[model samples]
Target: MSKSIDYGNMMHRAMRGLIAEVLEDVGANGLPGEHHFFITFDTRHPDVEMADWLFDRYPSEMTIVVQHWFDNLIVGSDGFQITLNFGDTPEPLAIPFDAIRTFVDPSVEFGLRFENQDGEEDDAEVVDLPDLDLAEALDLDKVEDPKPETASDDPAPAKDADVVSLDAFRKT
Candidate 1:
């Protein structure tokens, strides 16, 4: 006789439970100190909307940092609404829980990543990030790209780009 276990099913249920807990706390006004969310989600989901460029630019996953300037965060049984400061503009967004692709709290190292329950047209994409130096953070204007390394007589070795895996992680 053979018995089997399905970790995928287990993981899916666990993630669902975690989301419910967070929403419950939000409803009760029990969000702990300095614990805002960095939510990355699908722009094309039925419940999400933005300027058309948002879908064209980040059709799969777009991360929004919700720390300093976010406001009007209201929770409901089906979804939530919040206001985000996009540069000089204040944009109000209403998002269903189903639209969430990822949630991370850099302050506590807590993170949650969600998969598209329905089929996805495109695989997720992550772009190259510039080094978070003070100079780059302060400069809102464009900066020139660094020149490619030139070959020396010693013939230095080349390097490849890195791939960050989202697997092996779950919200704590």
Candidate 2:
């Protein structure tokens, strides 16, 4: 048998497309200049959580921010949530590990994406805050720094890379 499979590397490369999809959304709306995001997601995949008390809550991949008066912001591989200051009040939200859609820093042109994690295993594990803070996830300075924006005067943001073609993909 002379078959070798690099599933780990393959998964990483395949995931870049997913990340691109999320960034596309940011360019469309979130990019207003020097604005960033505090995206929280599930490291486990699939099993995302929200407040059981809210009726409007829907199980989806969501991304929040710390652009304004956000406090107690936390980031982990699985998911993230924070107390966004809306006017004079603050609310604490805890999102499931899998429900993160994307995190965009429009100030530069950098972002990342994640597919919803499947939370098949519900185990209690305390995650630690990494040394590299969320602010450095990619690089705000690189956000919205791409040159194509200057080339065209179109106000509308760029769209995500089409998956129908391999033109946007690269082999790992």
Candidate 3:
């Protein structure tokens, strides 16, 4: 069997490049007009460096707005550094591209979401199902048959081709 290339990961990295480019621009031109950003990142990521107190406050994740308050912005090849006020004290923050989860510019309603590869906050509830053949897998007698969707007294609206029915994969 041929191995499939991870195009999804490649695409994600490319999208991250967009954030880098925008940061570089802001670093140079100093955030032209109302083009600010709401950057959300995983604080648990190892490359993310910040003040101990700040990390303690935001133990899992944090969002920072890059507007009028930030200074000393440096956009590097792998990461970015910036200084922001934290309770009257200047706190320098270093955030790697890998730590970032979402970047948005509410000025234009543009945004991008990235997968957090650090394995942090994995709250997905996993349920294990028993292995069995299709016939033995289903308890047909215990399952009630689905009633047919009756035609309405008024003529039913046209069904859109884009609409999907999940009944095929349902246990019943």
Candidate 1 ranges with C-alpha deviation above 4 Å: 1-14, 20-31, 116-172
lDDT score of residue 78 within candidate 1: 62
Superposed Cα deviation of residue 45, candidate 3 (Å): 0.6
Better of 1 and 3 by TM-score: 3
**Candidate 1 lDDT tens digits, 27-78:** 4563466765556666777888666654675576555655444456677766
Better of 2 and 3 by lDDT: 3
Model 1 TM-score (2 dp):
0.54
* Pairs that collide, model 1: none
RMSD of each: 14.5, 14.7, 19.0
lDDT of 1 at 111: 60
lDDT, candidate 3, 30-55, per-residue tens? 77767767676778989999999979
Instruction: Report the lDDT of model 2 for residue 122.
Output: 23
* Model 2 lDDT at residue 123: 19
As for TM-score, the candidate ahead, 2 or 3, is 3
lDDT of each: 0.51, 0.38, 0.61
Per-model TM-score on C-alpha atoms: 0.54, 0.39, 0.65
lDDT of 2 by residue, 1-172 (tens): 7389756445544454444444444434444455554453433234543444321332332334435334444544443444543222355665543344444443554444443234432212212224334344434343322222221234444322100111111112
**Residue 93's C-alpha lDDT in candidate 1?**
71
> Where is model 3 more than 4 Å wrong at Cα?
117-172
Which residue pairs clash within candidate 3? none
Model 3, position 30, has a per-residue lDDT of: 79
